[model samples]
Target: ELKVEQNPLFLSMQEGKNYTIYCNYSTTSDRLYWYRQDPGKSLESLFVLLSNGAVKQEGRLMASLDTKARLSTLHITAAVHDLSATYFCAVDKSYGQNFVFGPGTRLSVLP
Candidate 1:
């Protein structure tokens, strides 16, 4: 069975600071996705990492995948209050398989 875990499930930071959220999977997976959810809202797709060393960035958020290590990271640079939300990482063992999601990391950016 594949399981996913995230570190520092809850994070509190000040605006303009930088932080990273890590996702680790118990099994090998070549595809990873990052999603964001605001309170009482649906999840929003942030990034899709399709291969080893794949990296994507939008605005202040960046995401990378390292398939060899079964790890993915979401890096937030210059965090702002608008970026405060729950972030989730999901991985699938292979194509067409159900994705296993990490317990979300709740982030709060104080002004």
Candidate 2:
């Protein structure tokens, strides 16, 4: 069975600081994804890591994947109040394009 896990389920950060959220999976996968969601809003795709060493960055957030380690990371740089949101990482299942998601990391940026 494949399982995805994320660390630091809740994070409190000061504006302008940097932080990293980790995602670990129990099985092998070549694809990973990062998503963000605001309170009372649906998730928005932030990145799609398609292969080993694949990385994507947008604004203050960057996501990377390491298939060898079955791990992925979401890095926050120069966090701002607008960057506060819940983030999730998911790994693609062995079959098709289905994905299993991690719980979520709720980030709060304090100004």
Candidate 3:
């Protein structure tokens, strides 16, 4: 079965901090996506990169995919209070028929 898992369900980082969240999958994938969600808000779509060597970024967050490794990375450059939210990376393994979402990474920005 194709599944997704993320480490550190909760993260507390000081202002101007950097971190990385890892996403691992159990099987092959055709596309990978990154999403961010703020408190009480719906998912804010981040990236929908296709193919193996695809990478995308915005603000303090950068995401990359490795089909060969079946892994994805979300690197946070410098976290701020505004960046305090939950992040998730999902994989489209079934070509839109099914989506496997990671456990999610909740970030707390300390001022």
- The CA lDDT of each predicted structure is 0.94, 0.93, 0.87
Q: lDDT for model 2, please.
A: 0.93
Question: What TM-score, to 2 decimals, does candidate 1 have?
Answer: 0.97
lDDT of 1 by residue, 10-111 (tens): 999999999999999998789999999999999898998999999999999999999999999999999999999999999977687578889999999999
Better of 2 and 3 by lDDT: 2
C-alpha RMSD values across all candidates: 0.8, 0.7, 1.2
Worst 10 residues of 3 by lDDT: 91-100
Give one digit per residue, the lDDT tens place, for model 2 in 1-111.
999999999999999999999999999899998989999999999999999999888888889999999989999999999999999998889758899999999999999
Q: What is the alpha-carbon lDDT of model 1 when measured against the actual structure?
A: 0.94
Question: 15 in model 1: Cα distance from truth in Å?
Answer: 0.3
Task: Give the lDDT of residue 15 in candidate 3.
Answer: 87
Worst 10 residues of 2 by lDDT: 90-99
- How many clashing pairs per prediction, in order? 0, 0, 0
User: TM-score, each model?
Assistant: 0.97, 0.97, 0.93
- What RMSD does model 1 have? 0.8
Q: lDDT of model 2 at residue 20?
A: 97
